[model samples]
Target: MQRIFANRARTPEGWLQDVIVSVEDGQIASIQAGQTPQPQDRRVDILLPSLGNLHSHSFQRAMAGMTEVRAAGKDSFWTWRTLMYRFMEHITPEQYEAIAALVFMEMLEAGYASVGEFHYVHHQPGGTRFETMTELSDRVFAAALKTGIGLTHLPVLYTYGGAGEQPLSGGQTRFGNTVDSFAELVTQARAHASRILPGDARVGIAPHSLRATSPRDLAEALMLKDEAPVHIHISEQPKEVADIQTWLGARPVEWLLNNAPVDTSWCLIHATHMTDKETRDMARSGAVAGLCPITEANLGDGPYNGPTFLAEGGAYGVGSDSNVRIALTEELRTLEYSQRLRDLQRNVMIPGEGSVGAAIYLDAARGGAQALGRQAGHISIGNLADLVALDGADTALCAVEGDQLLDALVFAADDNVVTDVWSAGRHMVRNGRHLEREQIVSSYTRAIRSLIDAI
Candidate 1:
């Protein structure tokens, strides 16, 4: 149990001054604003509910700057993927866990209290299942445990190579499994998750994409869905949309909405290219648009219809997808900047209900919590105790109050403005750094060196 008072705290009813938030048993016990600070209260100048990152490939953290060099001909997501496959083909289990630990730590330090890891690198280098099915799953669990980031383990189901049931090609063999094997894999993964994370972690199903499985097997993947949230990569590239239309007679989002039970329990990753109807229909379907702007820009994926989507009442959350760059302010900034560039205007994601910065953060928080199926994204009573305190003296937050503070932080912060973070009542970062940063970096350097040498 703990009590912390903030000079200004972003509560459900807007920012409140001189607020005391109580945490007990890893949940927000109570929030009392307009009160004098107690002698024992941990006090800060500014506090806000931490954001949850809704999509990630933790191992890709290693390949962050390695993919910058261009191939001989035209470069695109497909070409970059070829290099990714080559880079990952030699990663040992030790390297996988090490890289993931580094990534999870970076996320915590960046003010993200939770992550939905879209894990797919299963089996060994030669496409053979480990004697222990939860071997790599254990890596994700161990990384989360070491870092204190809330875990939403989305173990992916990757069966085929492309549309039309294409055979698993080289470098994709390790990610393949039959329906029966995947079920067994998920069952064992859950058993391990229960032991490691208990009720705090989510073990959800990720059907890699429409191209990774046939329509028939998609049903099998959804059968493993249970009550957990469903996340699928869809329509990220124009080529993917065309292939889906050619193969299924409908675009990816259109086909899924028509065929599957996509509701509030689903997150559609990178629905980059969509018609106005698709945007409206997606908003009405209650699915979260898991937008990863930095990764999209890194891969040259086209801008999404952000203005239309939000106007139609869509839910959205940002992610550190490729781990190329992980920063809370940067992700939010990039999201809005991309929209601004597309629309040739500013303040594009601002909601009528809140300030531009507060609106985006709140929406991302709620939508991220929805996608992760976690009791988080709020600094209110009975919600998970995940909070971040900004450096009140930082240039971005020094002179602002209420909504303007967030606006400045989002648009003006030059460095990490977050000073501290607590996930589920455990403080993992303070003074803008994770507690175990040095050790994590040591492990990451060793692991990355080994992988680079192997490559």
Candidate 2:
């Protein structure tokens, strides 16, 4: 089947006029500029490559609004984790699949074509393993398959509760595993997911955080570095920085840059707390900083120094880390907005002479592709046919072209303008709605209700 997209706003070569994109066999066959659409071609108003969510914890989507209430003292990421652990107690494989399907559907509606799921929940509530260790991972793949989204399945290895090889806390039991066990789990996940969607699904490795893995375990996990992309949670909170200093006499990102072989294949999530030296080192290493702006704001995580990082040529991509909210526009907006608040300057993200929104969107899209180890984040030839068509007739987007269209989409518009979405040439969302949203949401609602009742 061949389909063509016409009247795109932005492309690799800036704004194209009367462009036509051809897709065949789930890959972009050709992209021709100044071409009129044939009778058989599908015409769209505004076309752009869909985004890749570089970091996510899909099952955490169910815990979105449940942690909003103020706990005993000052609420923080640590308090949120307690609620998250409580929520994890009731998530069966079926519930996990349902929740993840709903979350992925939301991602499609929000203009993300793929997601890097930083999955770590492995065992039953009491740390008991299922007969098949890959049961949870199978559920994740099932969700992606049903939702028509590309997946970088990163199974996390969480050993200790914190730094210094601490024993696993009660709430952290389900996420704990030895390095050997994690290697076996990844092997199982790769083998099982291969039958589902071979090329569309990637199995990666993630050591939960510096606090959770010892130097030896972290080194062992890096042995799989050549096999797939490696991701990890770095210094997101000030306490985490203090803890790292206590344990290793250096910050998390600083230590990782010095110890680990940080490269393009690595994505350090929440390198939010870093010194000038650490930032410069990360920029030179070509590793991606997986920023989740919305989640960071929700958790009161400090803002990332976007200007300095970009000035030093650091790469970054956005994510829906906790799945608390899954809007590409909101993530981009929050990222810029956070920077604006920090720097007290407008248009701080744009370096050269172009639209700030377009620059940010394109950089994130490209960096996200590198982070996920996929030839995606563009609608060019030979790339996966993951595309998004915005409603060009929207009043806010009226008179928008090139970078202006990107600016409108990221700033003025939300998911409502995203009229169509295709992941790997499959129309997962049309008319601004996910194909299976009703059914998926119904199942998710039931599962979440049951979990809440059980708790």
Residue lDDT tens for model 1, 26-130? 899999889898899877778899888999999899999989998899999999999899888999889999999999999998889899999999989769888
Per-candidate clashes, comma-separated: 0, 0
What lDDT, from 0 to 1, does candidate 1 have? 0.89
Q: Each prediction's TM-score against the native? A: 0.98, 0.98
Model 1 regions more than 4 Å off: 351-354
Q: Give the TM-score of candidate 2.
A: 0.98
lDDT of each: 0.89, 0.89
**Considering summed lDDT, which 10 consecutive residues are worst modelled in model 2?**
1-10
Query: Model 2, range 1-455, lDDT digits (tens) per residue?
Result: 76665686467877777878878778899888888778987778888888899999988988888889999989999999888888888889999999999999999999889889999999998899989999999999989988999899999999999889999987688988998899899888988888887477799899999999999999998887655999999999999999999999999999999999989999999899998888888989999999999999999998997877888888899999998988899999999999999989898887667789888899999899889988888768899988888888998798777688888878898788888888878888888899888899999999999878888
